[model samples]
Target: MISDGVSVEALTQWQEATVGSLLSQALNRWPDRAAIRWPTPTGLKTLTWKQVWDSAASGAAQLRADDPTPIAIFAPNSEGWYLSLWAVALSGRPLVPINPALTEREVRAILMDSGASIVLAARDYRGRNLLEAVARLNIVDIQHLWDVDDWISATQSATGAIGAVAPQSTFVIQYTSGTTGTPKGVMLAHRACVNAASTLIATLEPGDDETCCSPSALHHVGALIAHALALARIGATYVMMNEFSAQGFVEAAASSRATILAGVPTMYSRVLDDPSFADVKLPDVRVLMLGGASIPVTLVSRLESHFGARVAVMYGQSEAPVITATRLDDPAWMKAHTVGRALPHREIQILGVATRSPADVGQIGEICVRTPVRMVGYLNLPDATSKAIDDEGWLHTGDLGALDVEGRLYFHGRLREMIVRGGENIYAREVEEVIESHPRVAEVAVVGLPDSDWGEIVAAAVVPRTGATVSADELSAWVERHLARYKRPTSWRFVDELPMTASGKPKKFAIVEWFGAIDGN
Candidate 1:
């Protein structure tokens, strides 16, 4: 076993078993430990490992009797939601969890692509009746396991060979947002899931006695399996939060007695904004993780002082999601400036965009990754999949970054979002990072807008810090001091707030409506 912390020999014992096998073992091991939690108007709801397993087993038995294939979950984050994931795994069937906030059209696209035989629609997820809604769509065969209780006992009589399902079998089909064109279903095999989980668990080094909390979505690997499942690998008690709220998080962490509560940059901002957390007792909390997007140095400094020596910064994506993460002991210079080195069994190479060769120290390039945990390409799109995953199996992550000699990577931005100002390429994330560091900026988003003179001009949207003066010129000058001339934003707008998805990444396309309404141009 590699000595990181969560060394369970999962790779050797159940390496060939399905995800359900892992879930089953985890549940059996900690039948009394709390596994999931959700929010209520008045308080929070929680589930123990045994209760979750029993519920999932019932769901799986129902699913197997119905179709013995993929089951799609069109819902939000909750205890039932997580139970559905385990249930699908237990049945040795693929599970599809769609974002609840997506439009009808977007939702339809996912349904069509997955070819799901059943959709698990229960009531009270963010107050939507997903069951009736999908039946209204009348797209594919859909069924509510809740609606059929008899199937559970009937199928359990024949729950044979399921626990032994091979790990290399397709475990999940998560669709990437179709921003570039159409959404592609990423098929992750059982082996891939196990490897990813093992690597992440080893990296975190959670103690067996640790209690963990994840407030992010489970559909996203960064939160789903990365932090939550990783902690669970070593028998750490895990508490789930339905949605992110500053007061709710602090209360839940204290309530569940969680030692590690994972958060994104936005989560940290909310806690800082929460008045109740200022004087609240947070003794159980130890590690505060920041990921999904880069953390501002100013925010880091403020959070470090406020949270007291446990804030860890990380940078990740859907592809190779656990690329680099900071350790609590990292020095200020490394912690503030870079995404830490790769987790165990993972390797990264920053190749110059033009050369496709290893970039010189501090030179930016397209970040490519080779990990045993990598997904089994985008489903059914062979040509598109071929372009992304090469013959050598390296996933071309389409994200740009610079590698320091110490092997830490500083993220630049998405390859498609790069701005070309009079033929000079500029990474918007690099510029936005600088803008976000300004004292008066609460949040910021940088994008390239059409400009007749320069082809594509760097435009930014800034959310001013609580009742503070923030001018376009001042922001532009701040970026200029930190970035090259062409990398600075040329045009900008200051707003009361910026639009974001539940995951806290700025929805760049959605901002058009808000920005257009504000400027009337």
Candidate 2:
């Protein structure tokens, strides 16, 4: 019914499917067509739909030979990573994705919690030897650890047939970005993922020949569902990046003749600032899709002018992907100011904190979503799961927003103290716990400071022990050992004492104002 010749009936059929079944359909429909394309030092590498399906089938066969426990992939985005992802799905094992930027301790915690028996990882990424780093964790539960190259090589001879998987079975155990100071594994069913991807594809309506360049990390749900699965559903070409760099993205987009590009606002800002961005001609690009963080109005205008593409803004979380998004035909003001209206078959309500009911139009409150794509629940945390999803089947997102009279949703901010730095969520308590562990620190409070480039940057306000002296460099080093690079505080302030309320809680608003004054904001 929309463009690109995808029928509403086809989307309805796909909503009740699994990833394996979809991949099988793609192989049959576009066997020789390009499925994935990525950059190499020499040039670009391309994989056809048949080649990807064969590789994944082989890998899935090998997985069937081992214990049927959850499998974790700890690597950057690459061809092998996609193959492994499909392999896990075909093998009927839940995939647990870990961010490659995480430290050894952080990786260990996920592996232990998920009880993943197998790990498919890159031998080295950036400067870290991931194999050695994971080995250093010394986790006894990890039974099989394969380097991606070796795993691909060993599975080449497999001839096992792919089996059908249940749509309601868990496909991915996606961990949140630690919005609550502790990372909770969100169990997404195959039906949820398939339906989410189908909805996104219907909304975007790209042609079968459309080529998309994506720089988002594969671990995040935004990229996994929106880019990876959605593109597959439509049988479009997907151009992936091992990691995101402004220059790298510009080069890939131009070289691939990309028709669609996707990334966070920070990535786009970096691209706009890059010198090569102006020189590169992305004339084929028709859509600039953005999500994962707030979109600055100026940045949206700049992106439109520079790329000559329609900018679409989306708002969602890992628990429920693609709750609301601006359509391709939306007016510029609507795209700039709101995240658009809820998609078809989805419902959104603004819960009034005071009235304990739906808020009036233009009244800001918590955003609640009821969708078929919502995650089944948090893994092994029934209490937390119940707290997030109410008895009415509505998932209460901790984000604050309001609905316009026209039914468009306007995003205000977060209800909790979660910092989104370059599209990565960092909880205030998570960072504060690390800083407070220092012997010379009495107490510490972490807050998000607004920035033009990064949506927000982590800032720490510390109180030193009596007669003790501590430097910012010392605290930074301490945090680096325990957390990821993005979670570390970039700005530090030492205060004699933190402002407190009568309830014996630190007044976070006062600290934010203090930082604003010091920065002359």
Candidate 3:
């Protein structure tokens, strides 16, 4: 076990020290400093540390007045949802954040499974009225928390339940996509939350003036909890966009004067593709953190040109809080490719025959990690939870990689056959699902093949759905705009039928061999 030498996590009373408490301390220390900001069609709104705390306290008080633990929140990225996240933790209540992009049916499943009592959703999102969907959740109180008027009224009511909550208390219930079956909710305990935040803050060394804007899904650990709270803990500024829009992101970075920005590869791809990038002067952006999918080498140069070569290509996952991150201080070449070094408090041991250990120099194997920030367990999935976190407490990351003699980490390949096209993860089954949704699509399988430009491009093979005439171009354009662009298949192939076993799963590798490529175009 590595000693952190007295920091955020690993301290005894951590569970009681809620993310709310961390915000409160920031508020007291820098009462006037801007804690969070977002640009609206009308204007930009900034929240001070104190203001964020009080709003959270108001939310905690309101939710605690009714339920003692685990309040629910469902909304696109917004200040209201962020406040409620803090409020729930402060009142010693766990927060359950559901995916806003999920269809109503999908949304309902998570709410019911997590047992979230109070649900806070937006009344309006991009002019789409989703309150009806929130209403259907049948949660205890389907309050529109983003109602600026309602939130302001609630915060000013002197209803904040002022108290200290332990860090070990349940803070949030994060649900993993149940592709194999039903999605399981992961209850992140307070100690784990503090440990995750402290691990990142101490290693990343977020400065007091540092500002971070992330396009990751808010319900995921990267945004709602890990990156968001970690920013507050370090007294840095936080910024959110209602949704990830390429043009909107460029504007937000400049509008908020954010110094630090983290986003998946797809988010940056559009920015790079735009001819206007040369004109969109995001001058204040000092550090750029890249993750989710493989970072494009082209992007490294573009980012260097844009941000003065201060880029960090990081590798992370929801299961393990940020495991590796590079810095602006590292060699520019290393910053462009390597996933940097293992986090300060983490231990890495490559598992397999050729992997003699880090001292072996050129070794390749799965990346197993032991850290203070890992989650307690996945909700209602004991067998899976046990498999994920071994008895030794080392997290067996599915990614394959190697450590050089210089102690830098280099990503090799994946143990699991998951597709990452433009930073949006396209689970084979998930894409194979949508392709089969077409009326003409009879059978289909999806895979991530190599691409020189966008890293891995999404490709698909389909067997027309029984005499239905669905042309490749039409299907490509159809699926393109339907799903998130990153998940959309760039290429497609129509076949007589798909190859499957007696149990029925696309022999993805074999399909790749037969079809040559999965192309929709």
Candidate 4:
């Protein structure tokens, strides 16, 4: 029946079902409600639930006769993105959403690896033209290349049998954010999507008319599954932003009177840094759901003080959406320190070095989770799937963390991201937290560089605050005072900006590459 905090009405309203069925229910319940709203060239465009459904149905009818090979969607956040997603699911085929920021080479790799037979993409976004991007791809598996406009066209008269997708069938193959290495396609079932959305909606309990402003990309978990689908579950209005800017987000929320706002820590930092943010007043704002990367405590404090909105820090990987989130009613300390206890009917465990046994309370270990919402596995990689999800069905997350006596999870850095300096383990997040605390440092990333003597040396890449400057030596001294001598950065580089994945996580590999290039190594 879901968690105690969730009302009985919500529990019954949210059952495990195919995403196609859920969309149908939403259309029947809120036919005339404003379902999707985004800015266009001439002006803003708003689509009702019925319009969205009818458009998707037309696309589904056309695709129902084709083979179920996964379709690759390469476009920015737009109404066309959602329409293609819903249409593919209704046709009983998996849809793979690719980040528009990926290089042509990277996109080619994913296309070849997934063996996608169909591609739906926009002509252009910002300056990057998708038509040119597709021309650069050397792969031959793609049987059809439908423009985003034509794929979601409401005027198409194609009519055919729309197959019913089983709840256990895969709906989307969401690729992992390639911060450390090449991205892998994660297979997510329809039931998993439904359960994850319901769990999040039930936990937040947003009103039926709750208006949500989402600045994150539609391809990512935060926007696609958690924010968009969750809002639709409650028949809420969704205010979509194609591209995120501090000024745009502030104005959109203020204009729409959005009650909920969601984004990554970097996005929120940009908002706070923007001078125009001071002029915007969002009295209807109730909560700011922060996810993607480790959040700074200072950011949370500033949001609460300035906006008078509760900040909920959410933690999850692409494999398992919404594993843990600090509830809005939780105390300030809990919200700041830990990603709250497991959601309803979900189990989380911390395994020690042994990897088989649970760690003692307050002991740091690898975080493993078992939930119905867990992904099926990585696409076309059975060995990788076996390694990720064990025989016992527990998804072994590479993240290291500790669980308190009360079952709250305290996240460390990724197990692979640990910088081993002369046999001593230094978590990147631990050192990053120290450097980011500096007044002049707006953002920082800590990584390990290969060294002949130390085996691996710690390095830091710093992004200065706008109109602020600090020398590398100054930052070194700041860290030296706060952290141990070994934990301090042995090398530092100041950059205008850090390379980031679409989800806003710093690409540490890219930072290391840039540092190496600068050093002429």
Give one digit per residue, the lDDT tens place, for model 2 in 1-521.
53345664567453678888778878987898899999999888999999999889999988887777899989888888888888888988999998888888889989998999998888879977787888888899999888865797687998766666889999999888754346789999998898888877776756657899988888887789888898888788999998778788988998999999998765776676556556765899999998876555556667877877888888888899888889888877688678988876689999985576999999877899998789899988999999999999999988778899889998765567667889876666557757766777766778888999999999999877656889999999999999999999999999887764211235566788789999899
**Using TM-score as the measure, what is the rank order of every candidate, best first?**
4, 1, 2, 3
lDDT (tens digit, per residue) of candidate 4 on 86-198: 78878888888888887888788888888888898889887888856886685678888878766666437888778778999998889899778878999999988888887
| Prediction 2 global C-alpha lDDT | 0.82
Window of ten residues with lowest summed lDDT in model 4: 1-10
Whole-model alpha-carbon lDDT for candidate 4? 0.82
Residue 81 in candidate 4 has what lDDT?
87
TM-scores for the candidates: 0.90, 0.80, 0.74, 0.95
Worst 10 residues of 3 by lDDT: 1-10
lDDT of each: 0.70, 0.82, 0.66, 0.82
Going through the candidates in order, what is the number of backbone clashes in each? 2, 0, 20, 0
Instruction: Look at candidate 4 and give me any clashing residue pairs.
Output: none
Q: Write the per-residue lDDT of candidate 1 for residues 300-319, one digit (tens) a residue.
A: 66766776646677765655
Model 1 C-alpha lDDT versus the unseen true structure: 0.70
The deviation in Å at residue 516 for candidate 1 is 5.8
Q: Which parts of model 1 are misplaced by more than 4 Å?
A: 1-17, 40-44, 125-127, 143-163, 178-181, 512-521
Candidates by lDDT, descending order: 4, 2, 1, 3
